[model samples]
Target chain A: MATKRIVVDPVTRIEGHLRVEAVVENGIITDAFSSGTMVRGLEIILKGRDPRDAWAFTQRACGVCTTVHALASVRTVEDAVGISVPKNAELIRNIMEAALYVQDHVVHFYHLHALDWVDVVSALSADPKETSRIAQSISHWPKSSVGYFKDVATRLKTFVESGQLGIFANGYWGHKAMKLPPEINLLAVAHYLEALEWQKEIVKIHAIFGGKNPHPNYLVGGVPCSINLNEVNAINSERLNHVSKLITDAMQFVNQVYIPDLMAIAPYYKDWGAIGGGMENFLCYGDFPTHGYNQTDSFKFPRGIILGQNLNEVVEVDARDPQQIKEYIKHSWYKYGAGDEAGLHPWEGETEFNFTGPKPPFDQLDVQNKYSWIKTPRWKDKAMEVGPLSRMLVAYAAGVTEVQDIVNDTLARLNVPVGALFSTLGRTAARGLETKLIVGWLKGFFDDLVTNVKAGDTTTFTKEKWEPSSWPQSCEGVGMTEAPRGALAHFIKINSGKIENYQLVVPTTWNASPRDPSGQKSAYETALIGTPIADKDMPLEILRTIHSFDPCLACSVHLYDPDGKHIHDIKVV
Target chain B: MLLLNPEGYMQNTKINTTLILGIGNTLLADEGVGVHVANYLNQKKLPDFVEVVDGGTGSFVLLGIMQNADRVILIDATIDGEKPGTIKRLTPKFSKDYPKTLTAHDIGLKDLLDAFYLLDTVPKVILYAISIAPLAEGLSLELSSEVESAIPEIVDQILKEIE
Candidate 1:
């Protein structure tokens, strides 16, 4: 049989413009290429800008995870100037960060990644009473009554009969790849609507602390919000109480609805546990600092590297070490000062355009050459995978009791072996487990905030090194944190209080990056190499593995054009 | 409970302010036209009831802002196979009324509008689609000369809408 190339340009339901090309031989992908089709010069724009204002601009890298960039950017400047925020400020940031993680994970599972698994059309065939029964068997979510499922079924019927699927239009409904029963599909559909309402309420936490949900205002030294129990205008007792309540609500959803649904659905797709395991080397910069930023022991998520699925050894990760973390653009559409093939540390990173691939409307990418806008970031000169799976595995290997207990409990419940944690299903399950752990941490952080406020320590800002005049003439710092997606780092070079250079190696870049100098395929490419294509036309299988990583190519690459004039339409047909 | 206004100001009562949201990435050349237009509008002395926002690329976070507003004017880059700087005005009642391809962050805005529709909180939405060349590389903070020249006209159009 002749090898056919399947290309899915502008992968739907993702954060940015991405093109995936797979070579199928005997209905199996033999080779794959993941290309970030956009390029925005954020690093170049940050040059000569005030270091303090970097967060506001850098956070624009992506619309989905805006807070993560701002958080990483502030930490980068704080690390450079040796500024430690007040304990109260740390607590507030932790609460806000945890809120983002919970909200982002839930949104990803339902809105962004769910349709890849649950067939929306099949829900119309579901018996609402049976769905209600199934929902009750899992957990005690209140919206599981037969009447509720019946209403949801009617809504699904209306949406289908309307002849306008809206968001569900692009889904490969009734495809052979979809394995969920109609009753289970109806249950997922009901939860999907519930999640939408739940997310809106959860973001109130961000609004309470940061003053906004999407693009929250952040100062260089501390959060923009000042805690004041007496002042009605400030983050008073009323608002604090509201945040606490929101956290409880979010935790209930994650515990009762999200985790139970994942467990119930996992049994139907156990075969996924054997597929989409790419680049066994995992990386996480460990986030949620309980103490000062410099104190590594205080981080709930530890920074380390687990190589080759070897749970026995965990290596320490020093993000600032140039020799340890470097980016190569040999197969990317950029040139380096050292040359095209040379690897440069992010501190010394350069963004120069050099598009050598065939122009758009072209059939296939020249995968052997420069084909993507994403730079291959190598950790210790190896392509490592980063995300919830990486964070879970690293924490488990480091013997984090909380992570171990959850992982053990989840594996035991699923009746799957420990090795199953290396596959796509594990990646998806890891996100749910991580969310459960973070919800617990969020409750503790909220309690700590309340305790601090009651203790009369309401200070949220430290203006120690805020002014440029009080700074060293030259310095550099690396801000590393575990974003909801994976490990995120912001490298900054400051000269006379202004940013001389700025570079960010986001999570998706590490996972969805193109080939590096060593000619090793990226995590996305390697994961797709052996994926069995039930139907090349449907390509649901491809979307399943890709969506497992929750690819945010917009955050990975900068912009979406190689030429200055031509516009390529994303044709769904 | 106190609500955070668009300007980060604390208001005693909920303000049914008119939101002028510019959604796009400024670093992506012409794609940032909406943001540029919003910034331009912000500089001008506008009515107290109008709030100009540079929404950037974050879509979900803007839902609260949209819900708070009585009316909304969204400016973004759209590719309708027209001239690079051609400006098209649309009052999108449904998500389907918007262009199929809305720059790189189409899902954010399109999906957001759908959510608003489902919740029945959708305000009167007037979109200014600044048709530009398709997304390709060559990143710049400056909008294309053609698009830059149309800013005054676009601002005037928006001013008239609010007036």
Candidate 2:
């Protein structure tokens, strides 16, 4: 048997650059790697700049998820200053976050991830009438209008005719792995175009409140904009209702269209689950609050720290543990102090550029750590994963009845028992379900804003004389927020009222990270170890598993061209 | 050259197909001349279809703009290898790397002519480059003897792009 490898450097459609490499032996994946290719010196740029400007600069690291970075940076500042956000501020932040989820999830499923499964060429073979019937069957999304579908077909036709293939150039259409019949593909294709329009409108919700969709402005103490009675009323009645309706319609579409599509496509490609499912270790910081805004009291999705291949549960980990979190710059271009002293808290951190290749594992684990700019993040000397699947699994295990029912019911439909819902597919499905639940919460948050307005307390903006000296000096604080991908934290120290040092333990740092000092693999990398590399020449299945983590490389801003540098000479003709 | 300003800023002339290329290093310090100029052009409210780009320090990229423009004006901090502030104007024919060390940010411009040649989408091109001596790190521009004196002349040349 012969093996072939197919590598697509700079995976298009997603924000930033991604390089995917798969090792295939006899039509099965023996190995795979998802490499982040772009180098952004955000950490270096942040050094010596006014701490307040970090919110502006760091957020631009990745335009797609800039909101998360901004919120994380602001939270870090708040933690250092030791100022408690007002209740209104909490509610506003929660609403803004919920809006981001609605926008991000919808866009990802339709634009970026959908291309993996939906075949556009197959859509051309579909009957228009049948396409309409299938779309209506899936959900009553207004964008699923027949006229809109026709327009989509026309635009796609022109795009293809133009021969530029802007977004569709890299897609694999004729592969045997494409499972859906022509009509279903046609329906999905139509929805994909409709999704583009719907996403544009949905982004308006971000602009209305936060100033922009990709990156939004949020004040630390409160939101930048004040809520008048009209604005408060409009937020719930118009903007939020529109968003909630989209969510409802989207959930229905997933149930009626996506799941059925996934199952239909699964048998044609039964080898996926076995290939890319890396180490079973899962982690999630948790989202949604049952009652209050306090991080500790609002809601607790039981923390999970899985050890080894046994999948055994251990004690919950703390976010504030400095010893648990260590950064090894040995392989990175950034130089650090001698071994065991390489790790520095965010406030006292030093970022110096030094691009070198792989080195020995930092901790004492027994695995070969290789590839990726993201450092392995451990919890109390143990490598733990972080993302939606982890959060869903922890919630389901703790018997969060809402998520449990959805997972169990979905599993029952799939003919698998409830226990099987603890796997990768379950984690992916949980993200969609969580979006539905969060949409409901957003409606309530909007309603409460109106209530606060009626009580004559719509005063949301606060302008105070802030002196740098007033903020804490020489103190460590953990800033955590549930970024769209997972939990994001910024650890920092302040000395002389300036950022003495800072460290960002981002979500991808946990998911796409390399192995730890103990030689324990990062969650996604560990998951990849057991996955059979199928059809190395066509690594779509491998991509699905990797993208499920939604890795963000901009946060880990160091890059190297190991394959030798010959710029592709991109000509914009 | 004809200058036509919509708001009477250029009431005395007529402007057509003006390609105002702003050049600078967005990541590098004072080298962001193009970005600042582009931002100013965006706010100045030019006529329809006027193209303005944050060209940064990529000269090879200028070939594309050069091919397809009625007129082109470039804004950059030039370290002429002359006196710090001296401004020089020469119709630089294509040398291997006309603008040596084009920044990574605007490297896209390096392949401009190649794109036009392959795609057959060439247009009439013109260029106006400025020589700001100091391209240091930090937002503020540090002008040398001759480079500082060239700002007014550069602005006049930019207004001339529309003319």
Cα lDDT listed for each candidate: 0.83, 0.53
iRMSD, all candidates: 5.2, 11.0
- lDDT score at residue A541, model 1, on the 0-100 scale: 85
In candidate 2 chain A, what residue range of length 10 has the lowest lDDT sum? A564-573
TM-score of chain A of 2: 0.83
Query: Which lDDT tens digits does candidate 1 get at residues B1-163?
Result: 1124422332213356788999888767788899999889989998888888878887776776677777889999976778888888998877777776565463577778877755546678988999877655555677888889989999999999999
Tens digits of per-residue lDDT for model 2 on A142-197?
55566766666666666555544334545677766677777777776665554443
Which digits, one per residue and each the tens of the lDDT, describe model 2 over residues B43-65? 67666657665443333323323
Give candidate 1 misplaced runs (Cα > 4 Å). A38-40, A556-573, B1-17, B43-50, B83-85, B104-106, B120-122, B134-136
Judging by DockQ against the true structure, name the best candidate: 1
Q: Output the number of the TM-score-best candidate.
A: 1
Candidate 1 docking band = acceptable
Q: What is the C-alpha RMSD of each candidate to the true structure, in Å?
A: 3.1, 9.0
